[model samples]
Target: MSKICEICGRKPHAGNQISHSAKKSTRWWHPNIQKVRVKLPDGRVKRMKICTRCLKAGKVQKAVS
Candidate 1:
Protein backbone atom coordinates (compact mmCIF):
# COMPACT_ATOMS: atom_id res chain seq x y z
CA MET A 1 0.00 0.00 0.00
CA SER A 2 1.03 3.60 -0.42
CA LYS A 3 2.73 5.19 2.57
CA ILE A 4 0.40 8.16 2.51
CA CYS A 5 -2.71 9.16 4.40
CA GLU A 6 -5.59 10.07 2.13
CA ILE A 7 -7.27 12.27 4.71
CA CYS A 8 -4.50 14.35 6.21
CA GLY A 9 -2.02 13.87 3.40
CA ARG A 10 0.49 12.58 5.87
CA LYS A 11 3.45 10.86 4.27
CA PRO A 12 6.72 9.28 5.32
CA HIS A 13 9.11 11.76 6.84
CA ALA A 14 12.89 11.57 6.49
CA GLY A 15 14.85 11.43 9.69
CA ASN A 16 17.90 9.94 11.32
CA GLN A 17 18.31 7.12 13.77
CA ILE A 18 20.98 8.02 16.26
CA SER A 19 23.01 5.26 17.87
CA HIS A 20 24.51 5.33 21.31
CA SER A 21 27.96 5.46 19.73
CA ALA A 22 27.06 8.81 18.08
CA LYS A 23 26.43 7.26 14.73
CA LYS A 24 23.45 8.30 12.66
CA SER A 25 21.56 6.45 9.98
CA THR A 26 18.91 7.60 7.59
CA ARG A 27 15.40 6.42 8.36
CA TRP A 28 11.82 7.14 7.42
CA TRP A 29 9.10 7.97 9.93
CA HIS A 30 5.79 6.82 8.56
CA PRO A 31 2.35 7.48 9.89
CA ASN A 32 0.08 4.80 11.24
CA ILE A 33 -2.28 4.43 8.31
CA GLN A 34 -5.08 1.95 7.90
CA LYS A 35 -7.48 1.23 5.11
CA VAL A 36 -10.89 2.21 6.34
CA ARG A 37 -14.33 2.82 4.96
CA VAL A 38 -15.12 6.50 5.14
CA LYS A 39 -18.41 8.24 4.59
CA LEU A 40 -18.33 11.30 2.41
CA PRO A 41 -20.49 14.41 2.40
CA ASP A 42 -22.33 13.12 -0.65
CA GLY A 43 -23.37 10.04 1.33
CA ARG A 44 -20.90 7.83 -0.41
CA VAL A 45 -18.73 5.38 1.48
CA LYS A 46 -15.32 4.54 0.09
CA ARG A 47 -12.19 2.81 1.26
CA MET A 48 -9.30 5.10 2.00
CA LYS A 49 -5.98 5.24 3.80
CA ILE A 50 -6.37 7.27 6.97
CA CYS A 51 -4.00 7.93 9.79
CA THR A 52 -4.86 6.96 13.34
CA ARG A 53 -4.53 10.53 14.52
CA CYS A 54 -7.34 11.68 12.20
CA LEU A 55 -9.52 8.85 13.39
CA LYS A 56 -8.91 9.80 16.99
CA ALA A 57 -9.66 13.43 16.24
CA GLY A 58 -12.90 12.54 14.42
CA LYS A 59 -11.87 14.42 11.32
CA VAL A 60 -13.85 12.20 9.00
CA GLN A 61 -16.94 10.09 9.15
CA LYS A 62 -16.12 6.40 9.51
CA ALA A 63 -18.36 3.82 7.97
CA VAL A 64 -19.98 1.44 10.38
CA SER A 65 -18.97 -2.16 10.09
Candidate 2:
Protein backbone atom coordinates (compact mmCIF):
# COMPACT_ATOMS: atom_id res chain seq x y z
CA MET A 1 0.00 0.00 0.00
CA SER A 2 1.09 3.56 -0.64
CA LYS A 3 2.28 5.42 2.43
CA ILE A 4 0.65 8.63 1.33
CA CYS A 5 -2.83 10.08 1.36
CA GLU A 6 -4.04 11.18 -2.04
CA ILE A 7 -6.59 13.60 -0.68
CA CYS A 8 -4.68 15.46 2.00
CA GLY A 9 -1.27 14.75 0.54
CA ARG A 10 -0.15 13.49 3.90
CA LYS A 11 3.09 11.57 3.97
CA PRO A 12 5.50 9.98 6.38
CA HIS A 13 7.39 12.31 8.69
CA ALA A 14 10.78 11.74 10.22
CA GLY A 15 11.53 12.34 13.85
CA ASN A 16 13.42 11.04 16.81
CA GLN A 17 12.46 8.90 19.77
CA ILE A 18 13.63 10.34 23.04
CA SER A 19 14.42 8.15 25.99
CA HIS A 20 14.51 8.95 29.65
CA SER A 21 18.28 8.64 29.58
CA ALA A 22 18.48 11.56 27.16
CA LYS A 23 19.03 9.20 24.30
CA LYS A 24 17.58 9.82 20.89
CA SER A 25 16.69 7.33 18.18
CA THR A 26 15.44 7.68 14.68
CA ARG A 27 11.74 7.17 14.05
CA TRP A 28 9.09 7.72 11.44
CA TRP A 29 5.65 9.21 11.83
CA HIS A 30 3.08 8.20 9.28
CA PRO A 31 -0.24 9.82 8.69
CA ASN A 32 -3.44 8.04 9.59
CA ILE A 33 -4.85 7.20 6.23
CA GLN A 34 -7.69 5.09 4.89
CA LYS A 35 -9.10 3.99 1.61
CA VAL A 36 -12.49 5.54 1.10
CA ARG A 37 -14.88 6.74 -1.56
CA VAL A 38 -15.64 10.44 -1.84
CA LYS A 39 -17.92 12.56 -3.91
CA LEU A 40 -16.41 14.70 -6.61
CA PRO A 41 -17.38 18.05 -8.00
CA ASP A 42 -19.25 16.33 -10.83
CA GLY A 43 -21.48 14.57 -8.34
CA ARG A 44 -19.68 11.31 -8.94
CA VAL A 45 -18.23 9.08 -6.31
CA LYS A 46 -14.68 7.77 -6.45
CA ARG A 47 -12.38 5.73 -4.30
CA MET A 48 -9.35 7.49 -2.92
CA LYS A 49 -6.75 7.34 -0.23
CA ILE A 50 -7.28 9.97 2.46
CA CYS A 51 -5.95 10.81 5.86
CA THR A 52 -8.05 10.26 8.97
CA ARG A 53 -7.48 13.85 10.12
CA CYS A 54 -9.16 15.14 7.02
CA LEU A 55 -12.10 12.89 7.61
CA LYS A 56 -12.35 13.97 11.22
CA ALA A 57 -11.95 17.60 10.26
CA GLY A 58 -14.79 17.22 7.74
CA LYS A 59 -12.52 18.18 4.90
CA VAL A 60 -13.87 15.48 2.69
CA GLN A 61 -17.29 16.25 1.37
CA LYS A 62 -18.86 12.88 0.63
CA ALA A 63 -17.90 9.27 0.64
CA VAL A 64 -17.51 7.41 -2.58
CA SER A 65 -20.37 5.07 -3.35
Candidate 3:
Protein backbone atom coordinates (compact mmCIF):
# COMPACT_ATOMS: atom_id res chain seq x y z
CA MET A 1 0.00 0.00 0.00
CA SER A 2 1.20 3.50 -0.75
CA LYS A 3 1.89 5.42 2.45
CA ILE A 4 0.70 8.76 1.18
CA CYS A 5 -2.29 10.95 1.87
CA GLU A 6 -4.18 11.47 -1.38
CA ILE A 7 -5.78 14.71 -0.31
CA CYS A 8 -3.06 16.51 1.62
CA GLY A 9 -0.09 14.91 -0.11
CA ARG A 10 1.31 13.84 3.22
CA LYS A 11 3.91 11.11 3.44
CA PRO A 12 6.64 9.71 5.62
CA HIS A 13 9.13 12.23 6.94
CA ALA A 14 12.73 11.63 7.97
CA GLY A 15 13.84 12.09 11.53
CA ASN A 16 16.11 10.69 14.20
CA GLN A 17 15.63 8.48 17.23
CA ILE A 18 17.69 9.11 20.32
CA SER A 19 18.65 6.34 22.69
CA HIS A 20 19.53 6.49 26.38
CA SER A 21 23.19 6.79 25.51
CA ALA A 22 22.46 9.86 23.32
CA LYS A 23 22.98 7.88 20.15
CA LYS A 24 20.87 9.03 17.23
CA SER A 25 19.51 6.80 14.50
CA THR A 26 17.63 7.43 11.31
CA ARG A 27 13.87 7.02 11.41
CA TRP A 28 10.77 7.75 9.34
CA TRP A 29 7.63 9.34 10.69
CA HIS A 30 4.59 8.19 8.77
CA PRO A 31 1.36 10.08 8.59
CA ASN A 32 -1.90 8.69 9.90
CA ILE A 33 -3.19 7.42 6.57
CA GLN A 34 -6.49 5.55 6.27
CA LYS A 35 -8.45 3.90 3.50
CA VAL A 36 -11.82 5.56 3.27
CA ARG A 37 -14.55 5.98 0.70
CA VAL A 38 -14.94 9.59 -0.20
CA LYS A 39 -17.91 11.27 -1.83
CA LEU A 40 -16.69 13.15 -4.82
CA PRO A 41 -18.16 16.28 -6.33
CA ASP A 42 -19.87 14.24 -9.05
CA GLY A 43 -21.45 12.04 -6.35
CA ARG A 44 -19.08 9.20 -6.93
CA VAL A 45 -17.74 7.19 -4.02
CA LYS A 46 -14.09 6.25 -4.34
CA ARG A 47 -11.63 4.72 -1.95
CA MET A 48 -8.55 6.76 -1.16
CA LYS A 49 -5.75 7.03 1.36
CA ILE A 50 -6.40 10.09 3.45
CA CYS A 51 -4.71 11.41 6.56
CA THR A 52 -6.49 11.78 9.87
CA ARG A 53 -5.98 15.51 9.88
CA CYS A 54 -7.86 15.91 6.59
CA LEU A 55 -10.62 13.66 7.84
CA LYS A 56 -10.98 15.60 11.08
CA ALA A 57 -10.85 18.91 9.21
CA GLY A 58 -13.68 17.86 6.85
CA LYS A 59 -11.52 18.37 3.79
CA VAL A 60 -13.50 15.67 2.01
CA GLN A 61 -16.94 14.23 2.46
CA LYS A 62 -17.21 10.62 3.56
CA ALA A 63 -19.49 8.06 1.96
CA VAL A 64 -21.92 6.87 4.57
CA SER A 65 -24.34 4.01 4.26
TM-score of each: 0.92, 0.80, 0.94
lDDT of 3 at 8: 85
User: Top model by TM-score, which number?
Assistant: 3
Please give the TM-score that candidate 2 achieves against the real structure. 0.80
Residue 5, model 2: lDDT of: 86
* lDDT by residue for model 1 (26-54), tens: 99899999988999999999999999999
Candidate 3 all-Cα RMSD:
0.8
Put down candidate 3 lDDT per residue, 1-65, tens digits, no spaces.
Answer: 89999998999999889999999999999999999999999999999999999999999999997
User: Could you give candidate 2's per-residue lDDT for residues 1-65 as a string of tens digits?
Assistant: 88798876889999999999989999999998788888887988888888898888888776634
Where in model 2 is the C-alpha error above 4 Å? none
The weakest ten consecutive residues by lDDT in model 3 span: 7-16
Collision count for each candidate, in order: 0, 3, 0
- Winning candidate number (lDDT): 3
**What are the lDDT scores of the predictions, listed in order?**
0.92, 0.84, 0.95
Residue pairs in steric clash, candidate 1? none
lDDT score, candidate 2, position 25: 98
* Superposed Cα RMSD, model 1: 0.9
